[model samples]
Target: MRKLILLITLTLSGTLAVGQTTQKPPLHGKHWMAITGKPLAATAGSMIFNKGGNAVDAACGILAANCTMWDVLSWGGETQALIYNPKTKKVIAINAMGVAPTGATPEFFKEKDMAYPPEFGPLAATTPGTPGGLMTMLAEYGTLSLAEVLAPAMEMAKGYPIEAQTATIIENQKHLIKEWPYSKKVFLPHLGEEREAPYPGEVFVQEDLFQTLKKLVDAEKEALAQGKNRKEAIYAAYARFYTGDIAEEIVRGTREQGGLFTMEDLAKWKVKIEEPLQVNYRGIDVYKLQEWTQGPAMLQSLNILENFDLKSMGYNSANYIHTVYQAMNLAFADRDFYYGDPAFEPKSPMKGLLSKEYARERAKLIKPINDPEIGPGDPYPFQGEKNPFLHLLEKQNEVIAYNNHGTAILGPDDPFLESFLAGTTSIQTADAEGWVVSVTPSGGWVPATIAGNTGVGLSQRMQSFVLDEKLNPFNVLEPGKRPRVTLTPSMALKDGKPYFSFAVQAGDTQDQNLLQMFLNVVEFDMTVQEAAEAANFNSYQMQSSFGAHESKPGAITLNTQIPSWIRGDLKKRGYKMDFLERTSGPLNAIWFDWKHGTFWGGSSNHGEDYGIAW
Candidate 1:
C-alpha cells in the first residue's frame, strides 16, 4: 500500500501531505476535478485529471471505475451526463440509456401470463447503452488514449478489496446476485455466505469483466483506421457482448432459467444519442433527459416553482416544503399522464397543452401557504400564441387570493392532483469549478428477472409511457431508445462563471434532495457537506407508476427530525405525514474557485465516496 501511494504521488509529481489519509485532496485552482459514487471511482477520475485530461476525460475515467468497482450501481445500466466547456462557454448533454427491444410490447407479458417483472425480464431489460456512450464521449471529446483512460479501472478490478458501499449493495440486492452463477462467482466469495456481509477490504476480481474490457480496448486501433467509423467499432464491441458467443451464452443461460431476453434483440440493439429536453428557468437554459424519466418533470417543477415565492418562504420550513410539494405534484401529474417515447404516441397537458404563456397562467394558481383544497390543473388549454390557458390563471385570482396574508388558497378543482412528496438529488462540484445536478427516480425498471442464465437483470422502464400508450419522444424503445429516465443533472452558473454542478442518483427522491440542496446553498449559504447531511423529505402528490415507500395521496414523509407537532398541524391541513428514520439522498458537489482559479470539491459523508483532485 505504501509503495502504491509513493508511485501515485511520484506519478502525479506531488508531495505527500503529513498525516494524509488514503484519500487525495480536492483539486484546487485551474486544475481539473472529478467525483463519482465511489472513492475508487473518484480516484480514477482524479488520475485522469492528473494525466492532463479535462472534465470529459475525467468523466470517462470515473465511468470506467463505475463499471469495475461500482458494478452493481454503475454499468450494465443507462448513463446520462451534462458537460460544459468553460473554454467555449457551451453546454451539451449525453443520453446513453438502454432501450427496450423493438419487438417488445407490454402485451407480450400479458400473452405470457406474466406480471411485468420488477427487475429482470425481456421487458425489464433494454439494450445496455453506457459502454456505447463512453465510447462516444471518448471519440468526440477525450484527449487521452483509451488504454490510458481504462487502465485505472482494470487495476482496481484486479486488485484491492471490495468497497463498503459496493458490499452493502451486494448484500441488499443479494437475491439478484445469488441467483446467477456468474454473478455469485464474482461476488459470493467476498460475502462468505449468503446474506453475510462482504468482508471489508477483501480483495475481489472481476476476471470476466476485465477480459471484456480488454477485448474492446484491443480493438481501438483497428477501429480508428481510416474509412472505419470509430463509433461503429464501439458498437461492434457491444454487439460481440450481446449478440456473439457472449450474448448467446447469456441468452441460453437466462432462457434455461426461463428468462426472455433474445439474441436477436441484442444483435439489433444500438445506443441512441437523443437531443435533451430544453427549458428556461429564470432566463437560464436547462436541459433534462426528456419523457423517459423525471428530467422533464423536474423542469415542470422548476417552472411551477417560478410561480411561487420560494425566496421569501424560508428554506425547509413547513410552509416552504408544502409549497414545493404542491408544485411537484402539479408537474408530475402531467409527467405520469403524458410522458413517453415521442416516437410513439405520448400525451402531455403541457404539450401544446400549455405553452410558455400558459405555464405563466398555471403558475398563478399556486398559493404561498398550504392549500387544503388543491384543484386539478387543466388538461386542455386553448391553442396558439393567444391561448385560453393564459386566461385560466387570470380568471380565478379574486376568489383564492389571501386578503390578509397575500397567499393563494386551494380551490375545489385541486382534488385532481395527488398529494405526495418524495425525490432524490445529487450534485457534483469539481476542482475545475464544474458543478452539476443529477436526480433520478428509483422506481424505474430494476431488480427483477425470471432467474436467468446471461445474468443480466432487466428493468421495467417501459412503464414510463405516454397517455396514448406511445413511448415519450426522448424515451422511445427503439433498438437504441434510451429509457425515459428521471435523472436530471444540473449546474448553476453565477456571473458568467461556473458555480456548482449537482447530480442526484435516487430514483424518485431526486427532486426533494435537489430542492433542499439548492436552498441550502443559494438561500441558506450552507456548505456542500451541511446541505448533504441535513435531514430530507419526499412528497408524492402525483399519480405515478413509480411507487413511493412512504407517500400516499395528499401526503408526505419526512425525516424524523421534522417536529412531530408539525405533523399534526400538517394533517389538519389535509396533508398526511409519515415520519421516517434516515431518508437521505447522496448530495455530491464541487464549489467553484472564485479566487486563485482553483476548484473545491467534496462528496457527502452521507455516502461511501471521496473527492479526488489533480
Candidate 2:
C-alpha cells in the first residue's frame, strides 16, 4: 500500500485520468433533444417535439411510451421528475410517488410473518402514480393536449414490436405472470406452448391497455366538446382516471387479485408540484427531488465533496473512489434512517442534513480505512432541535447491516444484488424554447400483476417501506404514507442557465452511479458520452432501499479495466473487491453548450438507451 501511494505520488499522470474516446458519437441538437432507455421511446419524444410541443410534453410522451413498451416499468408505477421550466426560470419537482393504500400498516406486514412487503403481487403495490404524473406535467407546463402527448404510446399499445429484453423477461418470469389472471391474459398470448411469452420483434398487441388509454383520450375529447380549455380538458381526463369508471376498474381488479386499492386511494392521491432541493457546488447549482426519493442524498454528498479536491486525486483513483464511497455511505446512512415522505410528522432534518457545517462534521469522520461501523449521524443536533427518535436512532445504526447481501463469489443475478439494481427507466428532453425535463419513472415491470382489465401494472414500491421504527422511523409503513424510494432524477444549472439534465434507472445504485457520472463531468473534463461509458465503481456499504434492505459494509465493486495495483490498494484498505465487465450506468444525460447555444446528449453505451438530436 505504501509503495502504491509512493507510485501515485511519483506518477500523478497514472493516477489522474485523461480524456477518453467514446464508442458512440456525441449527439448534437439545436431544436430539441430526446434521450431515453429505448430507441422507440426516444422517437416518441421526438414525435411530440416535431408536433411543436415543448420539453415537458415530449418528456411525457417518452415516459408514457416507455411504460407501454414495458421498458422495466408500466403505467401503474411511479414518476419522480425535475423539470426546468424556462417560464419560471427555476427547477420544479413533481412528487408523483404513490402512497400505501388503506390497511397497509407495519403491523399488517408483521402479522404476515414478513420482514418487509412482498417484492411482487397486489399486496406489494402502492396507488398508481405515473398516469397522474404525466397528466399533471402536461396540463400544467406543456402546450400540447394530453391526447397529443399520449398518441405515440397509444399507438404502441395497439401493436408494437416487442424488444428482446422485455420479451425474455416475460418468458423467464412466466410462472409469476401466470399467477395474475389479467397479466396471464396480456403477457402469455401463446400460453401452454413451449414459448409462453411473445417473441422478439413480434408485433405485440395490448387491446385492453389500448382501450384503457382510449377511455382517457375519450374523456379529453368529451371535455373539449363541452368547451373546456386544454388544461381543463386534461384534468377532465385525469379525473376520469382517478374518480370515474377507470378508478372503479382499478379498484375492482386490484381487490380480485388479492390486492388492496380503493376508489378513495385512487381519487385522494394527487400529484404534487413543489420546489426541489438544491445545493451549490463550486458555483454550480445541482438540483434533485426532495428526500422522499433519496435525491437529497446526492445533494448531501455534493456538500461533503465540496471540501475535497477530487480532481487532484485523479478520476476513479483509489483515493477518489474511497473518498466518494465513504461520502455516499454517509449520506445514504442518513437516507435509510431519516428520508421519508415529508408530509408526515417528524420531518427529516433537511436544514441540518444539507448544512455545510454538518457536512464538515461528517467529512471529518472519514478514516483511511473503510468503516463498517459508520452509520447515521445526528442531523437534528446540528439543526438545533432535539431528535424525536434519538433512542431509536442509536439502535438504528447497529441494525443497519446485513449478514450476507452478496458474496464475493455471487453472480450479478443474486437476488439481493439484482433487486438492488432493479427496474425503471429515465427520460431527458430539451427544446429550443428553453424547456428542460429529467424523469426517473419506475415500478410495475414485467411479471407484474395487471390490475383487472384496466391494463395497468401495479407498483411494487411498497417494499421500500420499513416494518420497524428501529430500522427507519420516518419510513415505517403506514396507510396513505409514501414509501421512501430510490428513484431520483437530476439536473444542474450554472450561472443561472441550464447546464445539464441527467438520470438513470436502478434501485439503490441510482444515486451512486449518478454521483460518479456528475463528477465525471464536473471534476474531470469528460464529455457527456465519455462519462456515460466510463468505468465506474460501486460501494455496497450503504443500506439498500430495495428488497431485503441489505447492507454489506466494506464491499466495493469495480470494472475489470481498473488498474490491478489500485484494486490491490483498495483491497488492502479492507474493501471486499468485486469485479464486473461493466459497472457504470446506462446513464442518460444532456449537456448544454451555453456558449454555442445547443444541446449535447449522452446516451449510455452500456444499455439499449438511445438518443436523437435535431
lDDT by residue (467-504, candidate 2, tens digit) is: 98888888888899999999999999999999989998
Candidates in order have lDDT scores of: 0.56, 0.90
Encode model 1's per-residue lDDT on 1-614: one tens digit a residue.
Answer: 99888878865776545543212334343565566677777777778778877677777778777666553333455566666655556556666666665555545555656433233433455555566667777666666767678889878766668866557756676677566565666666645555553666778766666766676666655566644565565545555666666677656655565445577766665545556665566655555655655667667767667676777877667777777777776665455444555544433344642356545665676665445334335545435333333343333222122221322223223321121222222324243434332322122122334223333334445443321222122233344344455666766666666666776665555655666676666667766656666666766544334322112345566777877666766666666666556555666766676766766665654455556655
* RMSD per model, one decimal: 8.8, 6.3
Cα error, candidate 2, residue 93 (Å): 0.5
In terms of TM-score, the best-performing candidate is 2
Per-prediction TM-score to the true structure, in the order listed? 0.77, 0.96
Model 2 residue 10 CA deviation (Å) reads: 37
